[model samples]
Target chain A: MRRIISILLLGIIALGITLSLAKIPFGTPKTKVGRYYIDKGVEETGATNIVTSVVVNYRAFDTLGEVTVLFIAAIGLGAVLTTGRRKKPERKIEPASLVLYTGCRFLFPLILLFGAYIFVHGHLTPGGGFQGGAIVASAFVLTYLGCRERRISERGSKLAESLGGLIFVIVGLVGLAVGGYFLMNFLPKGIPNFLFSAGIIPILYIVIGVKVGSELAGIIDNLIEESE
Target chain B: MSFLNHYIYYIGAFGLIFIGLYIVLVKHNLIKVIIGLSIMETGVNLFLISIGYIKGGTAPIFSTPEIEAARMVDPVPQALVLTAIVIGVAVLALALSLAIRLYQHYGTLNLRKIKEQRW
Candidate 1:
């Protein structure tokens, strides 16, 4: 009965959505705002990647809020999982295979480097802070799976997370002080396609990368600790 | 055939959305519900991305000097989806953590068995 009711509800929703969406034709330029951003974004931001400019330059305040939401989720997860923790009986665990351990040890630093490179070159390339941060966090996950005995330093991860957020806010504050608006791109818009170009965008993305990477890694750490 | 060509993406995206919603509404397992939520999010993200699609359009990046802004797809929705993906992950993690707490307290993941959780 429950399943039937739910299916009926979904069917009605599907019908309504299909009817409405049929009017909005696919594969068309629909929004003037998007067009404006595309046309003016390069000259205004000096970033080769228009998405980066949109994310870190034009809509930076929203990005900051998104980061804060991620931070809150991480903190909430940690709090939820860590509270009322009791001692668990230690179970004997087999060591990981030598091949697995060696591979993880070799690959971890390389992944971290690639993640940093992604965020650092965000303004010039298709990638940015969030993608890079996810990549970095994946490295941590790899470590957890392969290197069973190793643990991330709780203090260190927290510190990095806090510092990342602090730097983002400080940069925004600096921009506000200099340009009269928060998160203003007050720095020089250098030559396009260059690494040092795009003013404060690269800086903000890097800070976001660090903050997001650490926060995600911390969340992973909490969940893994809880299960084991 | 022309209808399929035109509305294929919309069909696929909405199919996933409906499936997810159905799972969420009908599934009793907490983990399954969470999985359903994830599928729904993925569907929504796809829908948003497809909304910005331009026929024969390139990515909205000026990586080369010859790349024309006129030929590039919309950057706005892509940017929105970028943040949305991150936020989705955060929400998923939080939900899973709550599920963990629920399991720990009740010793079962079934919504029907848990008195407080049952509607």
Candidate 2:
């Protein structure tokens, strides 16, 4: 009975969605705002990547709210998972083989470097802080899986998360003070396509990368602790 | 045939969304419901991205000198989806954490077995 009801509801939803969507032609350039951003993005933000310019410049405030939502979720996860611990005896997890351990140790730093590279070159390339941060978190996950005995430093991760958020907010405040608007591009937008260009965009992205990386790592730590 | 060619992406995305919705509604396991939620989010993200496609357009990046701004796909939806994906991840993690808590408290993952979970 429930399955039938669900199917009926879904059918209705699908019908409504399709009927509405069918009017909008496929694979066509729409959205005047998007076109404006594409045309003016390079000049206004000095970033070769229009997506990056839109994300960190035109819609940065939205990004900040998104980051806050992530932070809250991480905190909520920790709170929910850690409450009223059962105090069960810790189950022993078998250590990885010597070869696996050595390989993971060797690759860890390289993965971190690659993640850092992605966020640092966000303005010039397709990758950005969020992608880079996920990569960094994956590196943490790798370490967790490969090294059974090792644990990430809780204090250090928390500190990095806080500091990253602080940097973002401070940069925005500084922009407001200097440019008379919040999140304004107060600093000089250097030459396009260079590592040093895009002013606050790259800087904010790096901050976001660190914040997201630490938050995800912390979430992983909390879940691991729960299962442990 | 032409209709199919034109609306295939929309059809595919909506198919995912419907499947996700069915899973969320009919599944008895709490974890399955959360997984469904994630799948629905994926469909939504895919739909947002598809809305930005320009048939023969390139990405919105200026990777080369010859890539014209007029020929690029919309950047807005891409930007929106980027953050949405991260937010979705966050929400999924939170929901899973809640599931873990519920399992710990009730000692069961089946929504049907949980007395208060009856629809």
Candidate 3:
């Protein structure tokens, strides 16, 4: 009976959504602003990657809000899980196989390096801070899975998260002071297609990378500890 | 055939969305519901990305000088989706954590069996 009702409800909703979606033709250029970004993004942001420019330059305030949202979620997870917890006896965890443990230990630093590469080259490449940060977090997750006995330092992750958030806000405030607008591109935008180019963009992205990386690792830590 | 070609992406995206909705509405397990939510998020992300597609467009990045501005897809939606995807991850983790609390408190994973969650 429940399945029947849900299917009926979903069918109606899907019909409505599809009917509305049909009017918007697929595979067509839309949004005038998108065109503007494509034409002038390189010159304005000094970043060859237009998506990075849009994320870190054009709509930076929105990104800040998004980062805040992520932070709140991480905090909330910690709060929800830690509150009123009855201490259950620790469950014995079998050690991971030697092969698996050695592999994770070997690959962990390499994964961190790759994530750093992604965020640092965000202005000139396809990836940016968020993707890079997630990659970094995955490195932590890999460690958790392979090295069951090892616990991440909660204090260190929190410190990195706080520092990253501080730097982002500080940079924005500096822009506001110098350029009279929050998150303004106050620094010199060097030649495009270079690592050192795009001024505050790479700086902000690196900050975001660290922030997201630590926040996610913290969330994973909370969950893992709770499960254990 | 032409009609199918034009609407395939939409159909696929909406199909996933509907499937996720079904799981969320009908599934009894809290973890399954969270998984359903994640699936729905993936579907919505797909829909958003499809909205920015052009028939013969390349990515918005100018990795090479030869790539033309006129031939690139919309950057705005891609940027929005990037943030959305990360936010989705955060939400999923949070939801899973809540599920863990629910299981711990109730000692079972079933929605029907949990006294507080009974409909």
Candidate 4:
């Protein structure tokens, strides 16, 4: 009876959300922001993608907030997982079959390079901080899962995450220090369609990607260690 | 694409979201609840991706001659969905680990009995 009641209540809530979504409109009204995109974002940002414009420039503070959420989640996971009374012995993992291990070894550098490419080119392309960061994290995940017998270097991962996070803060601070606004494009806009023109945006994205990758690695490491 | 043209799929997707929520709310098993949450998330991502798809639109990859890049499906949502899927995995892993810890304490996966940690 209790379970049934809970289901009924959930159904009602779901119906309410559905109705709300049905009524709420998407595709924002073409207004000042839309015009701004047409006027400046196309080339000045050197990005072929408008979404990158919105993320990197028009509302960069929001991206900072999003990265912070991931950071907080990583910290929270660390806190929660460490709370148990008994620390389970990190168990032995069997050496992966030669086929799988060799394959991942071949793929790891390629994936990391791809992630770095995405991060640095965020200003000139569709990929940006979050996307690139997640990609880097994914590479780490594949390495952790496939190379089970190997130990993840905790110190390196921690340094990567912390430095990534610190760089983000410093990037924003440069905006505040140089001008009043937070996350202002600190560098002078160079010739349109060039890599150097986007200023701190590309660098910031690289930092975000590294941070995300390492934080995700930490989460996986803790989970696997505990589960063993 | 069928996803762009079909009104029925939208309804079905909404229905899936609804059912998933219902399961998540009522299920005693923690894994089932997580599954329910994941299904709901997939439905949301599907809806987001579908909105960007145009009728007869080709994939975002620019290798095709028949379809121009401008007319292809918007790549923005596809990119966002990729990020969202990773976030979902992170969330799911954290949730499952917490569930494991809870099981250790209570010796069962039932939510109702795990009231010791509840506010």
Model 1 DockQ reads: 0.89
State fnat for each of the candidate structures.
0.88, 0.88, 0.97, 0.18
lDDT of 2: 0.90
Residue-wise C-alpha lDDT for candidate 4, range B5-78, written one tens digit per residue: 45544666677787788877777788899999999998888777666666576554322234344445555566
lDDT of 3 by residue, A7-99 (tens): 899888988988887799899988999999989899998999999999999999999999999999999999988867587787899999999
Across all candidates, the chain A TM-score values are 0.96, 0.95, 0.95, 0.85
CA displacement after TM-score superposition, residue B113 of candidate 3 (Å): 2.4
lDDT of 3 at A168: 92
Candidate 4's docking class is acceptable
**How would you encode candidate 2's per-residue C-alpha lDDT over A1-228 as one tens digit per residue?**
888988898889888988887788889988999999989998899999999999999989999999999999999998887766567676788899999899999999999999999999999999999999999999999999897788899999999999998998999999899988889988788888888888899999999999999998888888888565
Give the runs in model 3 whose Cα sits over 4 Å from its true position.
Answer: A83-93
Global CA lDDT of candidate 3, please? 0.91
Candidate 2 residue pairs in clash (backbone atoms < 3 Å)? none
Per-prediction TM-score: 0.97, 0.97, 0.96, 0.80
When summed lDDT is taken over every stretch of 10 residues in candidate 2 chain B, the lowest stretch is: B86-95
Model with the higher TM-score, candidate 2 or 4: 2
**Residue B55 in candidate 4 has what lDDT?**
59
Docking class of 1: high
Ranking by lDDT: 1, 3, 2, 4
Candidate 2, residues B28-109, lDDT tens digits: the string is 9999999898889889888889999999999999878889988899999999999888888888888888888889889999
